[model samples]
Target: MTYALIAFALVLAVGVALLYNKLVRLRRAVENAFAQIDVQLQRRHDLIPNLVETAKAYLAHEQATFEGVARARSQAQIARSEASPTDAPSMRALAQAESGLGAALGRLMAVSEAHPTLQADAQMAALHEELASTENRIAFSRQAYNDSVTRYDVSVESVPGVFVAGPLGFKPAESLLEAPPEAAVAPRVAFA
Candidate 1:
């Protein structure tokens, strides 16, 4: 009876240890994924000022558009700084801020389209291309982050993991896949 009890405890200990190690790895992956998103978001934010400055020369009358973009960009930066994949509210805030910035940029692009001179400028063209590329990278990073979060969350919520996760402080992370209502439909920006 003593040997059987000892063997049972040994097996349970090993199983719990394995589960703990797996959770740790998944959590680390979630953090790494969010870091990638943060890097891309920083790049996007850095490019916005140059884009606005280049467009400013020809779109003098479009001050409102420029101001809107600036405001949205500032909000996004703040949200990005505070965001964590483990915190659902912070993640939601970041997504909302990013959506607002995208809408604002779209408006600026639409207004700039009216001025042929702006479209024809070499500097503006280059900046627009860079911004588009950055946007694509951000999209890819978000998708990757969401994937990581999904894996982590599932593990935290699953059977044996659920038994160990809460005791070990392994909370489920939030995914970046959910967009606000305003972002449900993409803004229309046509380039000729």
Candidate 2:
């Protein structure tokens, strides 16, 4: 009877240790994923000044639009700096700031479209391409972060995990980024 009890205790100890280690791994992964997103967002912010400068000459008439873009970019940078990947309210604020920046960029792009010379400028073209690529990378990073969060959240919420995770203080994480609404709609083509 003594040996049986000891064996049961050992097995339980091992199980608890494994569960603890697994939780730790998931938490680290979530942190790492968020770090990647932060890097991409910083890269995008760095590129914004160059993008605006490249378009400035052609957009000289649209000073107010430029100001709006500049303001939005500043707000986004501040928001991004304040946000942590795992915190929902901070992430939401960052997202809102980013959305404002996106709208400003869209207006800037529209202004560019009006100027054939601006569109044709080699430097402007390259800047546009680079900005587009950075946006794509941001999208990819957001997806990866969301994927990691989903996995961690699931592990923390599921049957056995629920009991272990709560006691361990593994709170659920929120996804900060999402595809823009326009991305869900199919493009319309008109042939003249």
Poorly placed runs, candidate 1 (over 4 Å) = 184-192
RMSD after Cα superposition, model 2: 3.8
Clashes of each: 0, 0
**Model 2 residue 49 lDDT score:** 83
lDDT of each: 0.89, 0.82
Score candidate 1 by TM-score against the native. Answer: 0.94
Per-residue lDDT of 2-35 in model 2, one digit per residue for the tens? 9999999999889878887888898898888888
Candidate 1 per-residue lDDT, tens place, 1-192, comes to 999999999999999999999999999999998999899999989999998999998888778889999999999999999998888899989999999998898888777777899999999899899989998888898899889888888899999999999999999998886456776465565445
Q: Which candidate leads the pack in TM-score?
A: 1
Question: Least accurate stretch of 10 residues (summed lDDT) in model 2?
Answer: 183-192
